[model samples]
Target: MPDEVIDCRGQRCPLPVIAAARRMPEVPVGTVVRVLADDPAAAVDIPAWCRMRGQEFLGSVDGPDGPAYDVRRTH
Candidate 1:
């Protein structure tokens, strides 16, 4: 399970990624944040953000609302 869950299903593109970034600081390192995004670009955007930001992209799965990305805070 994720330490936190941010619902961005209705949001578009960078918004999902941005929302996830904004919520990251609220959780401790090593914890995972599940980002729920409906935007198809999120599948690529989230992983790219993780690679650039040094966060661990634990990958994603089909969520009730959409695809939920499992992102672990590394820094």
Candidate 2:
């Protein structure tokens, strides 16, 4: 389970990534933050965001609405 779950289901491209960026800093390092996004762009953007931000992308899983992207805060 993730330490935090950010719901970006109805949001578009940059919003999901933006929400993650805004909220990730509040979580403790080594904890997981899950972003629930329905936008197709999330599939690509999430992992890229993780790479660019130096966080660990733990991959994603199917959710009721969309995919749940798991990110481990490394810093």
Candidate 3:
């Protein structure tokens, strides 16, 4: 499966994480979730959440608005 994009701009802490968690299952293993978030905390929170969830933190990129993360679920 190909990676999917989730727009999390304007969303707060747990919202972005929760939104990603909800969409993650739709994506197959080895695929990634490209989360676009404007939350500054996401720069740290997302990676930590991925780690805690046993997902692969593929890293992030600077988008026009904010940082976007690439997350691959292992399980």
lDDT of each: 0.91, 0.92, 0.85
lDDT tens digits by residue: candidate 3, 1-75: 226788999999988888888988877788888889988888888999998999888889986857898898788
User: Which pairs, if any, clash in model 1?
Assistant: none
Can you write out model 1's per-residue Cα lDDT over 25-73, one digit (the tens) per residue? 8889899999999899999999999999989999899956678999999
Query: Candidate 2's residue-wise lDDT over 1-75, tens digit each?
Result: 888788898999999999999988888899898999999999999999999989999999996857889999999
Off by over 4 Å in 3: none
RMSD of 1: 0.9
Point out the higher-scoring one by TM-score: 1 or 3.
1
How much lDDT does candidate 2 score? 0.92
- On TM-score, the stronger of 2 and 3 is 2
